[model samples]
Target chain A: MLARTSLRELRHRPLRTALALTGVAVATAMLVDMLMLGGGIQRSFEELLRSRGYELRLSPRGTLPFDTEATISGYAELRDALASVPEVAGVAPVLAYSISVETTDSPDEPQTSLRALALGIDPREQGLLRLLEGELPGSGEVLLDRRTIEETPLSVGDTVDLRVAGGLDVAARSGRARVSGIAEFVFSAREDRPIALPLEDLQSFSEMGDVVSFAMVRLTDGSEPDRVRADITARIDRVEVTTLTGIVTEANERLSYFRQLALILGSVSLVVTALLVGTIMAVSISERLGTIAALRAIGIPRMRILRALTAESLALCALAGLAGLGLGVVVAGVLEDILSDFPGLPQAVDFFVMRPSTLLLAYLLLLLVGAGAGLVPAWRATGLEVASLLHAEEP
Target chain B: MSPAGPARDTRGVIVVATDVTRDYRMSGSIVRALRGVSLSIPEGDFLAITGPSGSGKSTLLHLLGGVDVPTAGNVRFLDRDLGSMSVEARASLRLREVGLVFQRFHLLPMLTALENVELPLAAVGLGPGERRARAEERLVRVDLGDRLDHRPGELSGGQRQRVAIARALANDPAIVLADEPTGELDRSTSRSVLDLFRRLNDDGTTIVVATHDLELAEGARRRLEVVDGRVEA
Candidate 1:
């Protein structure tokens, strides 16, 4: 009966109830958006790393994969030592550098220089790139990323002139290779398209003999990447060995700022929800003090009254939480669309992804906030002196 | 000093008050609402307490109904000391034994007349079906069976008072305490309420009314007039 009374009261005061629900829903939506952003980027990066068959990456110490001008000096010795391990299936050496590509077919037209990420790999290794047309690149051949083909006049069977960007203490190097195939590579940074060539030829043309940026380690079936990474780190010096999990952990650590900002904003939203709900409940309870006092005089227990009031708040919050979930999805979808066009983020990576567990936790948080917001008013209602309040005039 | 009253029946005494003095602190001044006043109400008695405004008639009724405790002295209902009981315990006692009707008809504005009557039954832990049946019977007795679904705002002043009276009797309480139950009704409506009370008293339910109306007071089997916080002959 108390619950029914409470529901009836809420139904009668539609404007106040709607205001409280809107506050709760807006706060819940903010929290849901934060949860989506926190997990989406990490999951997308992990998927990108796992797409290649490589289990471990070896890069120069203090350098990331494809870091500009970063090269390991003893690549041959490192490769031989890694291949000697029992669990090692194959090792693909890579030399990645930023270079300008110009079309030789249209030299008379003002030469257009487009910057591209050039990757040096072994043709026989069947490495990271997924070929869509023609064969893999040979000694004097190149494989252009599909994006590169679409962005520029470059295509399969075209010979392009490439010039390596000059760095400190190293002069600019130039070379030409036939575009033998068009393919897709997951690691292509959003700002630059990728083009692949033979590692030996790239080394000879760039005058960086026996120097490579990183090595991709393909493990045998049933081999654990952690154990292999640890062994390689023990065998090699001045080198860093990492698995996909390690890279993701590092990336998430760097992105902790986003999580912190979300926490602050989400906390503010919760406080706003609590204050809004609490104020409305306080006003409603004050208005009904006479009725509550009458109920008390007629022998209704304080706890039962409190339960009815809290149940009303919980009902409002539950409705708001469901609405917030839909609102959050729409907001996340907008964020995803906006971020997909952002530079340096791969097209395959999602900016906001909703996981079931994350959404469940968000709902639970809203429930707690709702109950907590109602507690102050419920306590006040219970503490009213039945005799005094009954005698007191209605407010 | 005790006021002269009709012959008392010792075996049927249901409420007793001894030297009750209720004081209030208002704006730094001491106001004694009930100063050394005492009374006894017997079972099945229709008693009227008549007084002008601020004569402490309502305060005495509150004390007798276990809604408030006196600042000094003791009040007992059915041989149980109300002053010695906790607030919750007094509430429980009221739920089981005492019914109250307020002057203002403090029915929940959102609930129907039937639901308002069922509220007290729910407090006593009755199941929904049983509460509904009992509430319907009480509303019928009050001639409000057809108006069971109407809210307090939709009912006339007299009808609202009848609903309040019906709600007071929902638990079959041992005693019903009404404070000016007909104060807001017209003459005909007030007479009807008085007739209903007389009929309930004849049916063996103890009824106490606090009012300033001479007609309502004259109908009681015993009457006490209060002035300046003291009862007079």
Candidate 2:
């Protein structure tokens, strides 16, 4: 009966119902997109960070200055010294840098900034190279980063142009280096653009030899990460020693700001949706005054009045939510290209990929909004005077 | 369930309105719609209330049906004081006992003739098959069995009223209160609906018809006329 009544009411004023439904759809779509984007970006960031094969990240003494490379060469002897530490199994030295990948010969084409992390390691130990093609670089050969492998306009055995710099000492040099292979790190912490080169080659180009960036330490015993971390800090000096877990925590903090912005906008959109639903219900109840009065006069209980109206509101919102979900998917698809340029966010949101917890939260929010919208109108219908309504001349 | 079923206590008067007054606040000014109107209706009797538009006849019907609360006085049904009952109790009593038919038919536009008739039975938790069978029987009683699937819009005013009447008796209520049941019909249609009411009354359903039509008032077993919210002899 409630469904039937809602259908009748919706059919009675097609234009008004369509307009109200559209309003709800737009608001709901914006909120869904925001929420999905937040979730996807956070997941992408976590995935990127986890791929580095460390439980925690250790930074030097205080905070590492922004944009300044944290070199392992500064403490290279110290990293080699950690082999005696019983908790530590293997350590890989990593170099992080930013370089531009030229996709077009027309220098006018936008230069894409690539985040390159060059690792100086003996590939024979805990082999990190899940090579898509050629073998890992021997001494001088360089591997291209996964994201820019195809788009970097560099193929195997290509003579790549390079300009490496750090603070004051920098060199511009091009070399006929072999593109050994293309490999992907778990966390695409960088933007869509990524490039990787041999650590020795990068050191020579930047005029800093025998220096590595950071050491990624893998623990032999997973259960003792905290104890291992405290022992490492006690043993080390000047240079900061970090476990992989610390980097993940910092990365999560960095990701929360973007996610929070999306959430706030989503919340604002939901508020607008609630107002739209309330206004539509208020107008509907006022227009259907005679019908409500008729129902009351015919012995329909006040509770039924509340139930019917609430059912109508909820049905409308559910339909709108469905439409909004579709719109959100479309929005995510369309914006993926534009958002690829954003350094910290994922290129595309996970459309239709709602987590159970998030969906449950959204469901509860929509239900409350629907019930609140229907309450005042239902109350008004129940409180109406049936006698006056029946006897009064019809307008 | 039959009205003769063992549940009903049929020894006392069915309806008793004692000093019932309905007050309304219009534009912040209190206006008394019914001023100290009192009446007693016996079981199995057909009663008609007649009055001018503003003379409180509709108010009397609403009060009798337990659709609205009286401002100062009380209404008793089978010796149970309706005024003392909570809102939920009054609603239950109306659902399980009293039936109401309004002028303009008050048939839900979305419901077909049979579905409209089955509406009150929904309150009593009747199954769909039982409700349909009972609704069909009542519609046949009102001479509308063939038009069961027709919505109120497709039916004529008189047919709609007949459907409303069928709905009123769906729960086999002891008292059926009707407000201007024939006001929207032609003379012939009005007579037909009134005839159906007469037959239903003969079948032992106590009915209260509120109307301004003299002919309708005359057909009832007892008649009361109101003027300026007071009963007129």
Candidate 3:
């Protein structure tokens, strides 16, 4: 029924209806993008933290991962103590530092010495990077990042010299390692050139005995993260035990600027939608005032007329809002691409994530704008004086 | 072809307006459109309220049709006070009982002639098939059976008014209040529409036409002349 009368009225003015649809589509698209971005970063961070099933992180006191150069001194005893906790499944101690190395086994090309960020981990218990081609680094082997291989002419099965960087005596903590594989570093930013090796190798290379930057603790299934975290905090010292939830909360606080931006722009989009729909409907109803007044004279109820007008606006918004969702996905993809280039963010992290809730919220807001935009004009149109209008006299 | 006669209801009086005065506020002063006018329309009566433009003839008809409220008096339809009815109830009353026609014919320009006639039937909760059937019947009665698919822009002035008249009779109302049934038609077209109204009145459908044309007013069985918002002697 609404299709026949309400939609017909909208179809009567094709140019005006098309323009209204375009305006609403653009506004809703912006709104959807904002809705996605408002939570995308935080959600992606939480997913990254829980990706490897490690529910807790042990970082140096008052520092996030890779945030500072501070390390946990005497980490071997702490790692053993953490492994003894009842809820602990396994623990992987990781150390991060810089190393300067040149190819030792590749005799075809001239040796090019380059500095790279290095991670030393218990290879069997690590949850950080995925192997792309070859095996994890063993006793005398190293996993090179793709970027490091791109800079140096070394591939898997080649050997390179490794020396701990930024110390007074460079030769004291130096060793040679065979390239075992290429790896996908989960937290590698665009600027990072990284290499991974065993914990003892790096500890020996850096000459920092029994030291590491952090430890990732995997909890047994169904174990309460807070209980384990509390137990670890009580039993461990000189380290902070952070749960996945806490890391995500802290990330949200840090991403407050983006969230505020989303709120402002999302609100602007809604206002634009309402004003565009309202102005178009008001003008359309003004043009059709005579027809509306005649409809009233012929006994069409005000509620029915109002409903028809609202249906017209809703139809416009529904069609355009659907289009907006598709357009927003494309727009969000492009924006995520551009925003991910921000320095220090991991390559695997997304800035604009679309979920079911975002789509539903955007759709619901469109309907609200539709209803609000049509109400005032419809009320006025139905409230016209029938007798004066029919007589072609001003009321 | 013969037209349907007036509904066979035996009620005596259909509408009554007592000492009705309608005023308008224009440029800060009151313009009294109708001043202390009183009248009663009986069932099946062919009445015309004739006066020149701005003489309040249309205003009187509007009050009688329940489209406008009187500023100073009461309007009663079927022994029920119209002024006290809810706005929706009054609109329902007009939809189900009083058929209003305008000088311009006021046919929805966007609708085909049949769709225009179906508007009131749809308002009355008729199904699509039922609304179409009844709308076709009303248009055929007004000698517009062949013009059902034509829009008002495609029809002649007389045809449009015929469509308006058909719409007015769509629900088989007790009385139709036409403000100016043929004001926009040529003399011959006006007579054609007038003849259709006379045919309905002859078959006993009550009608009230407000017009400035004396010839059109003379065709009515009962004439009430309004001048300067009062009934003339």
Candidate 4:
């Protein structure tokens, strides 16, 4: 009976009920978005690391995975030695260098000179760059990342002039190569305009032979990356060897600040939800004081009355939770689109992703908040002086 | 405290008040709503309490119904001291043995006439089918059988008061306490309500009414007047 009565009352007051529901829904949406953003980017980054089947990364000691100007000297000997290992399936060396490229049609124009990252990789290696158009770069050809091609009006079969930027202990070099393909690199940073060419060609042009920035190692099936990393560390000196899992774990530790921000924002949303529902319920209970007093005089227990009031709040929260889930999905999608274009965020990393369990937990939390908010008004109703109120004039 | 379960055996007296005084602390002053007033209502008796405005007649009615406790004295319902009982205990007793009707009808505005009448029955943990049957019977007794589905807003003042009266009788209490039940109706409608009360009294349900209407007071078997919170001969 109490449940039925509460539903009837809520139905009769559509405008007030709608306002309260909208407040709860908006709060729920905010909470859902915060949960989604807490781990979305980290998950995307981990997936990118594993896409190329590379289990181990070899970089300069005391440097990050792709730090600029950090190169490994005597890379030819290291590559041969790593290939000789029984657990190693393949070893691919990469030279990362920034260069200035100019369109051939506008040779001397200042606007035609674009800064780009030049990646030197062996063309014979498989499972590296994903080709979208044309073929992979051969001996005298280069592959430009999609963004670089879009920015410069360059397409397959076009020739462009390149000038390497001077780095520590390395002189500047320049060359021209035919554009052989357009591709997307999974590891490219948001602002990086990348182009790939044959490793030997880039090494000869840049006068940096037998040196590379990093080596991506793919191990044989059933090989443990940790054991391989330990073996490599024991064999090699002046180099840091890390498995893909280790890199991802380190990245997640660094992204703990995002989780903390999400916590703070999520807490704020819950507080807002409580206040919104509480205020509305308080006002509604005040307006119905006379009826409540009448019920008390007619011998209704205070606990029963409280249960009815809480039932009303639960109904409203359940509806709001469903609406908020849909709204959160839309909001998260829009945020993902907007943040994908951020200047330095990786293209493969999404800023918002939905996990069903997290969303379900958020909905349950909102329902609990709704029940808690109803308590203030329920207490007030139970405290009414039935005898005095029944005789008093209506206010 | 002894277990006072609904007080079925009251030794022929359903309600008794001894030197009851009720004080109200309003702003800073202590305004005594009832002072040194005493009364006894026997089973199956039709009693009327008449007084002018602010005369504390409603306060005495509330005391008789066990809805309020006296500040300086004691009220006994079915030989059990109400002053010593917990609020929940008094509520339980009221649910089993007392009915209350207010001047403003007090019917839930959102519920139908039948649903409003079923409120008390539901409070007493009656089954849905039994509550519906009993509520319907009481509404029929109040001559609201044709208006079962009408909300309070759609009903006339007299009809709304009839619904309130039906709700008061939902639990089949030993006594019904009404405070100016006809104050909001016209003279004709008021007489019709009084006739319904007289009929219920004839059927052996004890009736206690507090009113300023002389006609209502004259129709009761026993009448008392109140002035300055004191009952007079």
Candidate 5:
């Protein structure tokens, strides 16, 4: 009887049913994409941080504020002294610089700001280099950010002209370095891009000599990073020392606002979906008032009528949820390709990974929406006056 | 024709109505649809309630069928008071013991002829195969064996009404309460439906029909005409 009633209600007004389905699908798809985007960002951040083998990122006191810029220097004598700390495993001196490159595809494109950090270290730490191709660049070679590929036309074995910040003369360095690789860095609390190279070569070419911008440290096993950072900060008065935990915390604090905004938008979409479903179900119940009365008159119990209607609502929601899930995956995939051109986004993040727990939660929410929409109508149908409704006279 | 056994008189009265009255709450006023109607129907009896429009015959049928409760008096079916039963229990009883046919032949629109007959059985705890077989048998009995898969919208008025009858008889109930079963049919179709009711009565399936058509009412074994909610001599 429920199957019969549901089918009849759905068929009676095909257009309305289709509209309800589409509304639910749209809402569910949006919800899924929102959740996927959040998860992808978190994953990309975590993976990027873990790849560098730096358990903690320490920065100067009040030096790197959110949406602001700051830098610290590593005096050669201080670097040697930091390596003498008991928990210090190794200190890789880093020279950081910012520059912009104009791609052949769009020459007038605003010089997109990039964080080019030169690492003065042995070329043996392959774990530190998250490469998408060939190999890590030698001293003379430079590796671009992984996100730069989609935005620029520079390919393997191509010479890139780089214009340093505050330098009027564009450095047209002609050298064919193997595409060597592309890599990701920890997402910043502000707009920051990552580019890597052999540390000493960058200093000599850019005329910024002997000044190490920062030092990335790998701690020994079982060494508490905060204790190490505190010890280092107390001893070093000339430059600031920031821990990796501090860096991650600051980054998350900034991303949390965007995540909350996404959540609010997703919730609003779901509420609209609920209203649409409720309206459609109400009309369906009203239109089928006569049929409900007929069933009741035939000695069919009121509860069965309620069950039948509830089942119908659930089936509708399930069907729409499944369709929406599929659509959401496709939409996210397409968006991923489009977002590739924008380096501000986390690179190569798969935004359509549907987790079972997420799908389960979504299904439950949709079921609740379906049941809630059907409640009033089910109650009204059960309470109908059988004699009045079933009488032969058309009133 | 009685079954060849000692008439199971110990089963008690199958349906008993004592001073049952039904009233409608109209626009700011209560209109009495039935007034102090009392009747009892034993098993295997065929009774007809006849009245004009607004005469309350349908009200009486509803009370007797347990589709409704009287506003004043009580209706007891098989020794259980209809008014006392919980809503769920009443529905269970309807599924188990009572079959209803209406003037409009209220077949579920989406169901085929056979499936429409099978609908009432769905709420029962019967297996799917048994439900299907029973529905098929009932449809075949109603002379719709060939139209098993034809939906109600595809069937004629007579065919649709036959499907309703098949649905009513699907549960093999104790009583079949039909409210103007032929009210929407042509003269020939009405006679054919009345003939079907007569045959069902002959088989000792208790039948109570509410109607205004004289020809339909006159053919019943027992007749009670209702006027202003009271039985007329």
Candidate 6:
């Protein structure tokens, strides 16, 4: 009955209740979003890193894999030596270079040329490219990402001429290859048109002898990554062996801005939620102080009255938090779409990932904020002088 | 003066105030409201404490009702010291033993007449069905049975006062302490409320009324007049 009464009192003034709920709901939604963003980038990066089952990466010494333009020499020797180590399932080397590809147009039109990023890798053993629409490209053919097909006139069956671009060999090393298939390049940004061809074709054409950017190591099933990394590191000189965990940690450090933003914004939203809830409760209790004193005079226990007040605040914050959770998921989707479009990001990484821990943390914070906000007014309401307030009605 | 104490017959006395003095510190100055004023209320007695405004009639009533402790001296409800009781225990005492009515009819505007009457009954932990029936019966006793569902804001002055009186009687207390029960009513309504008090006393309920209205005071079986916080009974 007391709860019923408390609920009725909140409903007694509908506009005030609605306004309070709106403010609290907005704050709650923001906090929920912040919670999702706090460690979401790191979590999703780790997921992407593990998706291919490539447990270790060998990058140029003092660099992340393919993080820079530095290349490793004698890729075939390095690959063979790493494959001989115990628990090493296979090793695939990768190299990236830019090329100007010109397509034959109609006789009435000039040739169309565009600069495209191309990868050099063994067709059978690489972890980076996945066949989405067509078969993997052979030596004389190249694979293009879906975006390149959509954004450019290139498709799976077009023969295009290529020359080394964006470095010392602007048009120096020239060749031609057919577009054999369209594939998914996991590291390509949304706007990047990338291609993949045989490692020897790219190495000989670009005139960078047996050179590759990095190598990815896929361990045998049930092999520990740390043990494999130690063996590979000892076996391969002039190469830095990076486990998936290490890369994720290093990327997370670089992305600390996201977590810091989440913490600051989440803290601000919590403070706002606390203030909105606290002010609403204080005003509601203030409006009913006379009735509270009268109830106290009529033998209603102070604890009971305070409990009713607490119920109001608890319900307000909890309901608002729930509503905000639903709203936050939608907002996070929109924000994620916007962020994933950022240039140079891994295609498989999500900007805002939702986890059960974030949801639980958000809700728990709201409950605590509600309890804290409600306590002040409840104490004030119960502390009023019953005799003075009650007997003010005497004359 | 004989120290202004109640009679020695403990069995007949339900409340006794021995030289009770109540003081208020207003704006950093002590203003005495009751100066060693003592009184006793016997079982089934309809006693009126009458005084003009600021003469401490309400203060005395507050002390007697166990709502406030005296500054100097003591008040006992059924031989238990009110000043010594815990706040919760004192509230429990009020719930099971004392009923209080106010002049302004301090009914929660959000509650209907029946709920207003049911407040004290609910305080005593009465079940829903029983408290509702009891509240209806109390409202009928005050002639406001038809207005049970009307909120206090929707009711007239007389009806609101009747609801308050019904609320005071809901717990079936041993004593009903009315602080100016008829003070806000018109002549006819005051007569009716005073008649209700007389009927309650006749039905063997102890009644205490603090009021300035002479007609209401004179209607009580015994009257104590106060001037400058001293009783001139």
Q: Of 1 and 2, which scores higher on DockQ?
A: 1
Alpha-carbon deviation at A173 in model 2, angstroms? 5.8
- Tell me which of candidates 2 and 5 scores higher on TM-score: 2
Clashing pairs in 1: none
Scored by Cα lDDT, where does model 1 land? Answer: 0.84
Please identify model 6 stretches exceeding 4 Å from their true place. A106-112, A166-171, A391-395, B1-10
Docking class of 3: medium
Grade the docking of candidate 1: medium
**Clashing residue pairs in candidate 3, if any?**
none
* Candidate 1 chain A weakest lDDT stretch, 10 residues: A104-113
Clashes of 6: 0
lDDT of 5 by residue, B1-233 (tens): 11111123357467999998888888989999988999999888889998888898888888887878889999988778899987667776777778888888888888888878877887675678988999999988878899999999999998899999999998888789988888889999999898988988898889999887899889898999899889995
TM-score of chain A of each: 0.85, 0.81, 0.92, 0.87, 0.75, 0.93
The candidate with the higher DockQ, 4 or 5, is 4
Candidate 1: interface RMSD in Å?
A: 1.4
- DockQ-sorted candidate list, best first: 4, 6, 3, 1, 5, 2
- Model 2 chain A: weakest 10-residue lDDT segment is A344-353
The Cα local distance difference test for each model comes to 0.84, 0.71, 0.86, 0.86, 0.72, 0.84
TM-score of 3: 0.94
Give the docking tier of candidate 2: medium
| Candidate 3 C-alpha lDDT tens digits along A225-306 | 9999999988886788898888889889999888999999999999999899889889988877777777788778888888
TM-score against truth, every candidate:
0.89, 0.88, 0.94, 0.88, 0.83, 0.93
Off by over 4 Å in 1: A39-55, A66-68, A102-113, A122-142, A149-184, A218-227, A243-246, A339-351, B1-11, B28-30
Please state the Cα-based DockQ of model 4 relative to the true two-chain complex: 0.61
For model 3, give the RMSD to the true fold: 3.1
Per-residue lDDT, model 3, residue B5, is 26
Per-prediction DockQ, in order? 0.58, 0.52, 0.59, 0.61, 0.56, 0.59
lDDT of 2 at B33: 86
Sort by TM-score, best first.
3, 6, 1, 2, 4, 5
